[model samples]
Target: MLSPYKVVTIGDAMITMNPISTGPLRFVTHFERKVGGAELNFAIGCARLGLQSRWISLLGKDEFGRVIYNFTRGEGVDMTHVQFVEGYPTSLNFKEIQEDGSGKTFYYRYQSPISTFTTEMMKDEMLEGVALLHLTGVFLAIDPKNVELVQELIQIAKQKNIPISFDPNIRLKLWSIEEARKVYEMIFPDIDILLTGLDEFRLITGKDSEAELENFAAVYNIRDLVIKDGANGSKLYREGMWTRVSSFKVTPVDTVGAGDGFDAGYVYGWLHSYEPDKLLRFANGVGALVTTVSGDNEGLPYFEEVDAFINNELIIER
Candidate 1:
């Protein structure tokens, strides 16, 4: 159990099976099992980048839970806050890749142990020394009970002056857009750092232009508003200044955890007091690097790997 972690992330921990063939369940011959949770992915990426990241979640007392526990622990993240409950199973997700390299996922996570989280399971000591509290929209959409837990933690973190890094990884599988927008509006003002997908942000705010987005951030009193433009790049609006950074070039194997990688990289840079350019470049570099592998956080590079990648390394494949 690692102590004095820099960040604390809360969300579901689940397994994903990506089918090799694109067809019905009968025709899809092969499937690969891997961890698939946005907050867990962020925690792993932060750990790889040399941060003592603590991930808090509820997992089932089963083999799937063991896989997540062992894998996350192996990544150097502190899972001491993870609560394992009985009678419920862990969540499972199935991924199907389309012909155009797009992905379609089917989640079988109803009544999962992770979704049964409550404030009692998450003790006060978990937020004692953490500088940042990381959250996502998934937690809000998972279950009604999670609302009390999330809002309580948010209030506690605010009282302790701990900033929150929020990623609205919108998922329609668990909830609808209208529901997401309404909950987000209520949760928006408490968030300090907003790392949002541009499309998702647009969908929620109806702000198509960057200027309009900036205004939206200002209205919410968001300290750091980061707009993720996928391959095009990332834009950061903070301290009354705007900065844009380009993404690194890489042939992607899977695009699952790139955004989480970016969140981790940006957090790492911020913790290390990096300049704006360095922060965005490092973030984009990490985001690009994660796409070279299949699993969510498998390709998340180490400290030296990030340096090498950002500095133009030799001609070789990852």
Candidate 2:
């Protein structure tokens, strides 16, 4: 197997099926299945950009579960630790895409086989060659036991001197705000780069303005903070300086996984030693490209594609 280029991400890997519909209440028309999870999307996004990435998760022994494993393997993800359980169905998420191709998703993931993950499922040897480890808030929402497992995993990485990247990929439907805030506070100190959005930051920190956000970042011992605002561009707060980067314009095909694409781009830049301005621009470019496609991982670009758009040799069509 090839060595990791920079980062390894850990979380649930699900088979996402989005059914075509004219509206939210409409019945399913047809469905398209894709592999998605915040961390998996981040890993795939990194791999597509020529970064050697790995994803650690669990899947059932069912056909759908095998499909997810095989798919990620084909994406060049190192799958040495993807556990397969007996007699459990893979966690699945269903989406209803409106005529405009924007809609909500409903997950059928409670009590999933993957939800049983503990530190035992993850091996110390598996993390040996990785330069960084990426995690998200979803792993925290699974269960208190799983939360403790994730925390232990991060602590291990920290002790091993591997960089830890965190994204508060906050989903209100998964847990209450108070519960989420309590957990966020517990995990913030262990994070190296905190990738979050305006809504999540405000909800977690109870802060409203940029100044308040900045002050919170300082107090939490966060090394870097990137706030993603869809279409409005992104803000980067690092080393006591703040820079705002404008987003690339695109006609969005779907908004799902756009933030994951953003995280992937930012991580790629971080691994490659790009300057702050360049990193933010490249991340926005990746995010804008993801919006033009129907699936989160489908629209992610290779280096050549991103370079073409960045260099203005090709126009980004809506």
Candidate 3:
């Protein structure tokens, strides 16, 4: 089957590490490495779901950067827009998982090559073929230059009538609440599709009613609004219709990146002309599937996997 649309995503990518041992740090002696970045993961998810995805980033020339670059390339995401810069070290992050499945993450991305990105790096000619532009809040806070670039990209996407998908993957540790709010307000008016976690939405908007959700969408003229509430599933609002889709049952390893995976699934539906219910079901399934494995994108389902899951066909291991 052909993809619903072609996409181009922009943001930072980094090496993610999680302790192999479950208990205290003193006893945890080893760690497993994985590559994760909000936009990067979204690109992988889209590609896995049978879409043409291109991920653009400024990575360091270090081994860590090479690891992400090679892995992303191997995953079938277009890497022509990715540039590995010399003299800058790739970023690293560590995830300390608690016994109860909670995780604490520490980031070391300051001064990374991606933080030096500027608008001159964007490839405008490529936008002609792209069906959508994907972005996250992470890049806006990474650097002032990136903030300018985000605005420029949004404007360009609007001019070309290309849909813009945004996820406010809020990382409070990276920037202050005030800073995040400022950027959100500036871009809120331009977002065509808004994917936000229920918690994050409440945290930012301070309102929990469906009316509040619709009010924001109506005022902003957002065509698609998805509110993801983990475990309980997600709800989508569009064109005066509201649909709630249930989450699939799965034993979650690490819940990080599920939202990004879900975004990919929902965007796939939008690309392929799926009805709202099917879109949410597919998105919820994709989100839950990603949580079955430890790393971010490791559990991202391929087309066959998604098909099997949605069709109620289970694969039993021998």
Candidate 4:
């Protein structure tokens, strides 16, 4: 058996909705509820691939919230830091899936209980057994209190010599570009592994070329940097070496959660000490597979699925 590394994820968890069609003209819709958050998705993705993962967040005292808590716990995720809040509503996101698997997502999340998390709620030992602390920019974007609390969490991780990974999965609906720019500036120096999209790079550096993106990562001294270009593959910079990795050629059913799947796949590769190229391949394979289904996190391939997909045994179609 492989050794397990304790992975810690911090962010908001929500109820996700994805509609599926059953016919050409008339469609029957079915809903699958799961814990959905950028960081939480990454953690769940890691857990699905056999890592010992944990999640920390504030869940509302509601039926929907309890469902999320129970589901994740049942998946073998440690929920030691999850707090049940009495007066707040859990966040919710809805996706409308077309027959071809394309969709639009809407978020209903302001004033969520998770955004109310404060530094006081965290303890030093909350991170005791963590080997890696994973965070998403959405937490910082959601609230100032969460930003401060995340800063504290990062400090604790640093103090304990635990590496930190950041996915600046920026949501333009959450804040103004200027506000996000300032936050990124404040947090860049603290991030170890930085995962972002080409749009994020363009927005952050005002640069359109991969050369400029690589230069930007070098300027920040990030150990592992990935610039994701949707469906076009991703570029990675590590240990002063840069590599352009091609993505799997597949017709996407829905693009949502694909990047999160990529983030999860890359984290799994990092935790398991896979080679750089293999890591990129694994990440891209999972990302491609995710698009074959709907929802923010459904169809996230497990280790077995990933292995089969990468080996070309599992043929994906449009």
Off by over 4 Å in 3: 1-4, 23-28, 315-318
**Candidate 4 residue-wise lDDT, 141-184, digit = tens:** 88866778888998999899998888888888888888888888
lDDT of 3 by residue, 92-203 (tens): 8887777886667888887899876777766576566889998899888777677788888888888899999899988888888788888888898999999998888887
Error of 3 at 138 (Å): 1.6
Model 1 residue runs over 4 Å out of place are 1-5, 98-100, 314-318
- lDDT by residue for model 1 over 1-318, one digit each (tens)? 232448999989789887868765556889888887999999999988888899988899999999989989988888888978898899999887766767677888888997667676656788888888999998788886776788988988988899998998898878889988988998899998899988888888888687897788889999889988878989889888999998888888878899999999998888777888888999998988888887877888887888888999823285
TM-score for candidate 4, residues paired by index: 0.90
Please report the TM-score between candidate 2 and the true structure: 0.94
Clashes of 1: 0
Score candidate 1 by lDDT: 0.85
| Residue 174's lDDT in candidate 1 | 83
Q: Against the unseen true structure, what C-alpha lDDT does each candidate score? A: 0.85, 0.82, 0.86, 0.81
lDDT accuracy of residue 96 in candidate 2: 70
lDDT digits (tens) for residues 42-107 of candidate 2? 888888888888788888889989998898899887787788988778888887756765567788
Q: lDDT rank, highest first?
A: 3, 1, 2, 4
Q: List the residue pairs that clash in candidate 1.
A: none
